[model samples]
Target chain A: AQSVTQLDSQVPVFEEAPVELRCNYSSSVSVYLFWYVQYPNQGLQLLLKYLSGSTLVKGINGFEAEFNKSQTSFHLRKPSVHISDTAEYFCAVSEWHSGAGSYQLTFGKGTKLSVIP
Target chain B: DAGVTQSPTHLIKTRGQQVTLRCSPKSGHDTVSWYQQALGQGPQFIFQYYEEEERQRGNFPDRFSGHQFPNYSSELNVNALLLGDSALYLCASSLRYYEQYFGPGTRLTVT
Candidate 1:
C-alpha cells in the first residue's frame, strides 16, 4: 500500500517570505503525486500534480513542487507567499500502474500553512 | 465550467440512522470518487464509480455504500452510522487518469 508523510503539522511564515512544505511517500510501484489546498470548511482544491515528464510541477497561486524519485519526496514550494495563501495543504499519491477499475489515493495528514501579515 | 457539486450541504443524523449524500460531477467527467474528511485531517478515499458501476473502494466498512447513475452523478449512502462516521464527505470528478476536481462537500454530523 502507498502512504504519504507530511513533516510539518504547522508552518508559520510572514508575508513575502518563501515557504517549503515537505512531503514523502512510500510506494512499491510507480505513482502520481499531487498537492491540494483546503480552506476552512471547504473541500480540497488541486494546487498541482506530477503525472509524468516533469520533476518540477507548477501550480496555481504561484506554488510549485519537485518530484524527487531518489528521495521519494514531492516537496511543495513557493518563492513568495501572501496572507491569502493560508490554508491546509495536503500531499496525495495514486498508483500509476493500477488498472481501469481502481485509482485509489493515499494522502498525508496535512500541513497548516499560516501566512502572517 | 462549474466544478463538482455535492448536495445537502449540511446534515445531522443520529446513531444507527441512515443518510445519503448526492454529487454531480463536472462537465465532461465520467468518474466520481468519494472521500471522508474529518476535522483537522486530510480526506480519506471512500470509493470511486464509473459507468454506473463501483470501480474502487478503500478500507472502509460495508456500512459505507454508494451508487453512480448514467448521468455520471453519484450518491453516498451510509447505513447504521456511528459517531465515528461524522465527517465532511467530499465528491470529486475526473476523466481517465486525470487530476480530479472537488465539490464543496456535505458536512455529515452523527450524534
Candidate 2:
C-alpha cells in the first residue's frame, strides 16, 4: 500500500510571489507522482505528472515539481503565482497493485493555496 | 475531444433509497473508474471498469455496485443510501495502463 502526505494544509501567498507545497510519499515499490488542482465546485485538473523521467517535472500554469527519490518527496513549486492560482492542490502517488493487477492512485489530504493581492 | 463526463450534476435521495449515477468515458478511452469525494477531503477510489467488466475495486461495501456498457459508458449504483453517503461522485476515464482524466463529478446528497 502507498500513502501520500502533504506537509501543509494551507498556503497563503501574495500575488506574484513564489510558493512551494511539500508532498511526501511512502511506498514499497516504484511509483508515479502527480499534482492536481481543483477550483471551487469543479473536478480536479492535472497539473503535472512524473511517470518516469528527469528529476524535475514541469506542469501547466507555470507549476513544477521535483521527484526526489531519496527524500520520498515530490514538492510542487512555482516562480510566481497569480490570484487565479488560488485553489486546492492534491499530491498523488500511483503504484502497481500486484493483488489487483492495476495501478491505483493514493492522494494526499490536499493543500489549499490562497493568493492575495 | 470531450473529457470524461458524468450525468445528473446533482441528486438528492433519502436514506434507504437507491441511486444510480452515469458516466461517459472520454473519446478513445476504454477504462472507466469511479471515486467518492467527501467535503474537504480527497477523492477515494471505488472501482474501475474495463472491457465491459470490473477490473478493479477498492475498499467499499457491497451496496456499491457498477456496470460498464459496450460503448464504454458506466454507471455507479449505491443501495441503502445513508446521510454519510452524501458526497461528490467522480468519474474518470483512461487508457489501460495510463493516467486518468476526470469529470466534473455528480453531487449526491442523501437526506
lDDT of 2 by residue, B23-102 (tens): 99999999898999999998898999988888788899999999999999999999999999999999989898788889
The Cα error of candidate 1 at residue B75, in Å, is: 0.5
lDDT of 2 by residue, A18-61 (tens): 99999999999999999999999999899999999799999999
Checking candidate 1 for backbone clashes, the offending pairs are: none
Local lDDT at A59 for model 2: 94
lDDT per residue, candidate 1, A55-90, as tens digits? 999999899999999999999999999999999999
Kindly list the interface RMSD, in angstroms, of each predicted candidate in the order they appear: 1.5, 0.9
